[model samples]
Target: MIRPNMERPTMKRREFLATTTALGALTLVTPGRLLAETPVAGGTLVWGHSETTQNLDMHQTGTASTSRVLQNIHNALVTVNSDMEVVPQLAESYEVSDDGLEYTFRLRAGVMFHDGSTLTSEDVKYSFERCADPETGATNFEVFNDVAGIETPDELTVIVRMTRPNAPFLARLAENGAGVVMPAGSGDIQGTTPVGAGPFRFIRREFGNEVVLERFDDYWDGPAHLERIIAREITEPTVRLTGLRTGELHMINDIPAERVAEVEGDASLQVLTWFPLNFDFLNFNHDLELFQDARVRRAFDLMIDKEMLLQGALWGQGETTASASFPNDAARNTDITQRGQDIAAARALLSEAGHPPGSLNVVFKVTTNYPYHVESAQIIAEWAREAGVNMTIEQLTWADWLSQVWVDRDFQMTMMNFFTIWEPDRLYFSLWHSTGGFNYRNINVPEIDALAEEARGTIDADARNALYRRIQDMVSEEALDVILWFRNGSIGARSEVAGLDTLVHPNGSNLNFHKVWLRS
Candidate 1:
């Protein structure tokens, strides 16, 4: 894991923010070993969800907000732990073939789904098939690229044979959408309501306001400590803080960085801070003739300073980076320098692309789902205008953005921010591959495709990491996308809330409230 050990920083907030997710020191002022005390159950915990969930169908949704809540209501075949290792969750145990092509998973015995159906190998097979089905419109269809066949040897055992050796195939299964298992026919009706054999089960979603979940005593892993959890949507920072302070909320995730000191100073409130494996990036649609020129794309990237944007848009809550990989990742090419803000250089690039500064006019579309996305886009738009580039900002609601910008690929340019399970294959293959499942930007290049295939099949850790580094270098040098920063998150909670490690205080920021409890 990239998470650093907590230490109070001696530097200023902005400078310290760059040192090991720099915000880790914020937790020091929190009292009473919060979330480390003996667990107790039977209380309702209302937390402020950063955004509204698109849907409960985990496989079909692309947003982290959806997975954040679905994780509490669903179980995966395997899961990532605090240490970032792949371990069994729904599957009691699993075995892999030495050839790195076949896997055998034994489902936990006597597990029951929310609808009282017993979990069997069939359920696992059904989930994978549904996710792989193009008709299902799942976000993780590419995850099954190596699958030759899925077989159920018995009621409890599922065997998967790959068409070719896939080194990270097992690890990919631990990701939210790919690994999540539901009942045989659950895929048919997972939109408004979903069912699974987990510590919590779906109760109801009050549209844009909130989604509710209740404890499941029949869960194979045992019941969640809280009797109920309400994920209330409140995007405004001030409103969320008010709810938290007024005792209307037990916890608030993604607290604005400016309020970290205040939350930490309150004796009744505690802060939970960590570096989330998430990023904000600018994407250019290759289908658009304007973005087809690499020089034009580079010029757009050069117009704005990533550091300035980080502080302006996020209050310096994250680390600046140019590649899809995190700033501190080993695979990042450190030798390549991220260009500073220079209007002269940017205008020169536009001239080289045959579109002089005044000649370049484009539309930049962004989503309102994340306030930072709109804020950062506006910041950069002003910079581009100063560079003699005529730019317009068009904001869309989350649902419209998903269809117009993501699925339809109908926009010239856009900025996106998201979090998910991180690995070489998950990061590179899903975004840069010619026909990647999530290649919404239409980044189709022969070299990137070749390197992605090679890296996906390469088994040795050191060899594959080198290949991934090459991919990162190519993506950045070609300006496939402008990755501005890797986000660090802070969660504010009442001191009475404990067992956070069991919630989102773990790998990939995957949420599982089953293990967390409210101190009585």
Candidate 2:
């Protein structure tokens, strides 16, 4: 196991926002207790996940299941810490040119890849260039579109020149796939074979069951204390909770809301809530004629009550919001008023959109796996009935939802959570920009796209925030999508597991195992 001999994290600043996530507050462990305790080495940490993952290739799929294991397998140039601040990981330090288009990164000398190969600037160049390559088909290729060129002046230095000044460029580099440095000239990145320079090395992956990784003894900083880390897929929540209670698993994620109290009551278990960085929303398929009318879209937003959905579906574990952006975000429009449940107003809008009684018929597509999606759909269908619209619910698997809604664009409305990235550009611009690769909803507002592009180039923080504020207002005014509640993420683990309660990342997917150790 590789351990980073880095500086201890500073006290969290009050400026730091309690971000969004699907998890709620934890009751068992405190940061002070974990820090004050002595760490013991050589124990295996077994984690339970709710879904099956195909491979460790983050470049292809950015799913949470893949990230939970891959973060220990790959090291990024920059990474976010528990305080939600971006810190250096692989690169020792970085500087931006005065022109704002060039970023120079100094690679750490002693870092080593999982294959026992020494880290060099060439590997860094290759890792990024591979993703930027048009032929590689990286899911986040759009993030690298501004890269004009990459130059490796020496074995320890690499410089990236962008075609335009992108203010969110550095934050984007800290993102999952964009941050990881892979081996140069390696075989297919997405294939079964895997290698990275993180704390743990890939031992084996038992498809649909678990992924096993052992500590790298020759790690640059030092060998990790834990002998092994196993990420197991236990799709059933009850089974996962049982595993933690029975001491079969050290940590588990995606704990059900009703189980929070039960876990808290157990002295042997701990529930750690992550910052809010997740939201479940109904994404309107703008390509469909049924959602083309602005009044019709607005009617859907007004008909359903966000507070009721939060209480009934989420079990009152989330916060309601009117804007598409995270409520804690600096750029979020605070003035935008939520339409609140107004059946009369919703009916008037529907009538204006020429959708009188029984004139509107649509299918609400949702997933049965995650929280709130199924429950929210059922409640939405009831609300739709009162608004003189026929909305039927159709539950599909995650894979089928991806193929049918994201790829085929065949759905009228689909419910999915936006596991937002830390940066506003990725969270908003990537999903709403006209040319955005992930823009599943056919939102092609030229004005909004222009503003989004403008914000990307604005180097000043205040200026960029103002631009995002306008964009959020525009998105809310148009009702392009329903802005649901921001969710809290939780980590259910045994009381013996330490260090994990201190770390926090957006979506709680980027689990850092280096600091994690079993208490003696």
Candidate 3:
């Protein structure tokens, strides 16, 4: 029932200029129909992606731009609900062994892929094998490391064996790309045009312009609310909002801080704001001799003025944060939040590092995909100059930034927001651990690796929280990464858009549109 949709509209430069914009997603809640106010389906949605997805391979793509769209086009053996709890999706039921080393999943019957094929345990085995293969290069490889082997006894039953007990193992299964299941031996097809058992199916892509998807009638959970979705690649925030305002687009994202008041006043637009699970931080290339010194790193960390950043870049829209860890456990102070909010400890630390004042000059690479990031970097550059550190801001397009800064690792320093993930291990183990699969910055501290590894194996909440607290202290004292603040995310849409209440995303970052319908 799935085929390349031929109805995609081609756009010229002037047409593109008028309709360009972006969309910001939010926390996952209940699956579709929870906000049932009586549904009216069947309409096209022109959703916005501030950046185009360079990697369509969900099994390996680390970027949110790719995974957001892929979320609608695929399903995994397990997924999360509105409570952010791991639940079954393609797998109707699952059980864990008492030893916590093996997981047995029973596949749901009649689950169909985009290519008109029924799902089987063999497909699950193939996908798991791909994650185990180092060649796949999945971002959250640490999560899959516990997976020792896969055993498929029958068409509907599959078992996953783990090397050790992992508390967050099931939760990680709800992550993007890493947990996605596709047809067996269709790895090549997934890298280009993916086929999965999602409520929607991929149609075509015009390379950095737009992606099209059609509703899957044979979906196991039933048909989706919307008939078609067009994810438009528009990098400019103003242009995106303009399209939303003019009714050329149904929804927009990444609303600029200055435009918040305007969107709130407009009766025709609906403003969605939430305190997202994310942090803005500066990433350093540890391979550089200058960053190898702990003192230099601390000096840069101390140079951050959180108040200035919140006001200047985010227009004081978010709360300031000094801690390196998420504030999930407040009772134990597991976050290890730096109570002494100081932005002027640089001079002494720089002196101790043996670097003469004004001897350091570095390029802070930032992505244009996120408007706030550029503003944040600009503000940071000003503070650096006061501390005798020369700073040059280097702006790169979203695709280029992903390749040069994230994939190629040719950048000296960069800044970005950590994507929304509920678990601390998902946040720290992949980025802070020395041998982490997604350790793009080349951070190689044996202590961080040891502490994070210790936390990963521990399932007890109290013990794990204690270990994470130590990791947080180490990250702050050593200045592993200069975390600036807790960011607030905003999403703007037209008044006519409905079913968004049903978009219970798994990782709190991707946009699932199965329940999102247009009001007729």
User: Which one is best on TM-score?
Assistant: 1
Clashes of each: 2, 16, 6
TM per candidate: 0.93, 0.91, 0.90
What lDDT score is found at residue 496 in candidate 3?
75
Which 10-residue window in model 1 sums to the lowest lDDT? 2-11
Report the lDDT tens digits of candidate 2 across residue range 402-510.
6788778889998877664547887767778887756888889899898988888887767888888888888888898887877767778877788774444543445
lDDT of 1 by residue, 102-174 (tens): 8888888999999999999999999999999889988888889889999998989999999887877767787
Looking at model 1, the pairs that clash are: 35-498, 35-499
Report every candidate's CA lDDT.
0.79, 0.75, 0.75
Among all windows of 10 consecutive residues in model 3, the one with the lowest summed lDDT is 1-10
Q: What residue pairs are clashing in model 3?
A: 21-240, 22-253, 23-253, 24-253, 28-505, 29-82
lDDT of 1 at 221: 75
Query: Residue-wise lDDT of candidate 3 within 458-500, one digit each (tens)?
Result: 7666677677677767777777887677666667788778866
Greater-TM-score candidate between 1 and 2: 1
Tell me the deviation in Å of residue 202 in model 1.
0.3
Full-model lDDT, candidate 3: 0.75
